[model samples]
Target: MLLNHNQSSLSFHSELYSFVPEDHILRRVHDLVDFSFINDLVKESYCVYYGRPANEPELLFRLLFLQFLYNLSDERVIEDSQYNLAYKWFLGLNPEDSLPDSSQLSRFRVHRLGANRVEKVLEHIVKQCVEKGLIQSKALIIDSTHTLANAAKGKPLDVLKKAANRLLKGVKKQYSSLYKKLPMFPKLEGADEEKAKQLLQYLVELRNLLEDKLPDAEGSLLEKINTVKQIIEDERLLTNKGIASAVDPDARFGRKSNSRTFYGFKNHIAMTEEEIITAIHVTPGNEDDGKQLQTLVNKTREQQITIDEVFADTAYSRKENLTFLQTDEIKASIPLNPAVYGTREDDKFQYDKENDEVICPAGHTSIRKAKTGRTGTGTNPCLTFYFDTNICKQCPFKDGCYNNTKEKTYSISIKSEEHIHQMAYLDSDEYLQRKGLRSNIEHKNAELKNAHRMTRAKYRGQFGMRIQAFLTAFVVNVKRMIKLEMAHSE
Candidate 1:
């Protein structure tokens, strides 16, 4: 069973070979990258000389890859491998080969190819594309997308109390002695629910009592109780933990600008200038997008891809990110946040950095210039300009721009010189070209959500979400490399 002995060879009577066209994407994917790398990546996860053999690791992983490649669920992919000739050809199955049950794919993913190997397998496939000249990697386009969590946003107070009590009863078999002495949690129902405040306080107390009594308890039990305790502490309405899924408590409430909000995870991606995704990372929903640029940059270097420029939207325009990219000698094409620049209109004043002074709107220059070194925490200080308000009071624009100041000479601070210099290219033709390329990542995000089934996670928990992202990106790269190859041929 482990050896996959049902493979078919060239035959005069068979039409399987002619069924698929030469221009098919799967054929291109198969011929482009070697699947042999999977066997090496997952060999240690399997039993070498075992009792009743198991599904071959390579075939199983290929089936999972097929699911991601075409956006099929586990059942659909297995069904396709059984009846679809193109799928059969891709899986190297004989005409009468039996499809494994759908349950097998789930078990293999959770048990066989855990998070580590899943990541490494993706990297190995990327290396193949690099050798074939499909990915240039000279520039990286960065962005993030949200995936909704499987759990509900809020559970009623009574509902949560019952759920928690049920979990405690289920665990009683392991700690019979400890369970008997534990305090019975108060069960509050009905209109007293608005006393949800009291309910939270009670849960926190119960959690502390349980931990104090069972000091040496398994970490998992402690974690469940702790999750409930933290939920009580974080939310006034007492929605599960800060996470939406109690079972998958790692997912968080992610904020996307001021308009959209969802409970789930965020996928941060770094794509090559050619549009192939080179790296991806998953973070809690509420995490800041600005924090992951350095991490994505690090992943590219680990794969030996040199990143000469990184372009991102305003969400990733924090000072630290700009400084890091600058220190690394990679061009940081981040736009300035509106908060960084005050009420200065376009061409309101021209700044001469070499002379260390600014000309006001009325055509008079500032009286003095001041600057400070980097803070102990390492962020660049804003450059402050001192304006003589006595002169400003006589100017036409003073009523609109300078009324907020107290000094006869008003002082204004703007973001660092480096940030201003980097943002100066906002109007260049070259900048617009590159920015257009950055927006193309939105199409890729759509493809993942629409074509690859990333809209809602198929499995629960953070690691499961990561597996889904990695495999989806791998399949996408395979398809893209083929398209690029075909276009070149044409």
Candidate 2:
């Protein structure tokens, strides 16, 4: 239950905030930003007439703001807020007011402002900047950064054993009777593959037993059961990149470059040239960066920011993305991905955009076309056009052109008119100038990792990573808003 009042009641020691400095960052943040919306944002998570009156959502949210702002742990943030006058003032607490336990921070993050609501935290702050006329840039720079998983990557057998142990541990802690009724883990002596299979079968039986005994299990117990189910269902657990760690099943192996790799997740972000982030989308490490462009753009537009230009690297230069930008009339400063637009090596084959077909030098048009190869896997997919082999067989120029095979085909790397136009724009002075704007996002990524502890996952799983990401973004945006407002005054 939420209280229908603010928590900033005056106290006998209220004057302690005077020494917190007139221009303290927290004081400026308190004065400039309105955090009252948090109460409404998380209102649905609480019961109106059940249980004890809950801690004020706004106050709890302020603790999260302080946590990400200073990169402090939940315990540290709560401990500091207990006595720090500025923190107390920023949280709308009178001096000497008691703080909710540090554990409440995790509860609030998971139950109150969950993944569905965390995005709103970033969105709300961005809308505030827009409302204040501080985010005036028409260009949105986009990029992605990596965060290492909290759990270490493990082999399939090790992962299976770890998951089994955790489920048993949770059941033992929460339901000791159920623990005895559950199947005991068996010892096996065999090859790793055989051992993994045995462990997997054991987990399958254990899950079945739990389902029968606890039909309505929820909370951490439910999560453990679900994790076991995922592990059991993954057919390629031994052969492919599936479930590296039972602790973090959602994280995957992603390549940072041709030779470098990391085990974790990705934070796809869109920001204004003003250096304020407008949108953030977190995905598994191996997820494609280009696919998130549309989502980021839509989220940024949702904040009422007029976006006329977008800046990104070659990773975002897919033909589909370019077409979307063309349809929306948004200027794209992204460089062409060489895999999408390779050199026109063979002048004999010309592409016809309007017909969406390629013409051979002999004036014969392709009959059917098919795309080959997986996208976003550091591979070049080709749009191959098949021709009537009879036509090629009878052509006078068939000597060296058509190999005497069962079929005749000509292939061109995916070449769209939007890509052609973008390629042309890539050489212009304006494109080069606007391209430099994307570098600031790299610095923003650095700040998130270096200054805000976003370099590694603080908690396990994607939801935890997302919670960390949005809260971190929220803190940086508020700081950026302060700087922008101050500059406008100067």
- Among the numbered candidates, top TM-score falls to 2
In candidate 1, which residue pairs clash?
A: 254-285, 389-408
Relative to the true structure, how large is the alpha-carbon lDDT of every model? 0.74, 0.89
Q: How well does each candidate superpose onto the true structure, as a TM-score?
A: 0.79, 0.86
Instruction: RMSD for all candidates, in order, please.
Output: 5.2, 5.7
- Candidate 1 weakest ten by summed lDDT: 236-245
Best by lDDT: 2
Candidate 2: deviation at residue 361, Å? 22
Candidate 2 residue-wise lDDT, 77-138, digit = tens: 99999988889888888887899999989999999999989999888998888888898789
In the range 1-490, model 1's lDDT, one tens digit per residue, is 3454445666553576677888777787778779878766766766666756776666787798889877788989998788877887777766666877899898788767777778786688778878888786598889999888766655546535644674477457678887777667666555655555566666677677777776776655765776676565555345444544456666787787788788889999988877788889988787888889899989877988988888898778777787788888887777767656644565477667688777776778888767744575434555567777777777777765677566534334455766676777665767776776778899899998998878887777788898888889888888778888787789
lDDT of 1 at 112: 72
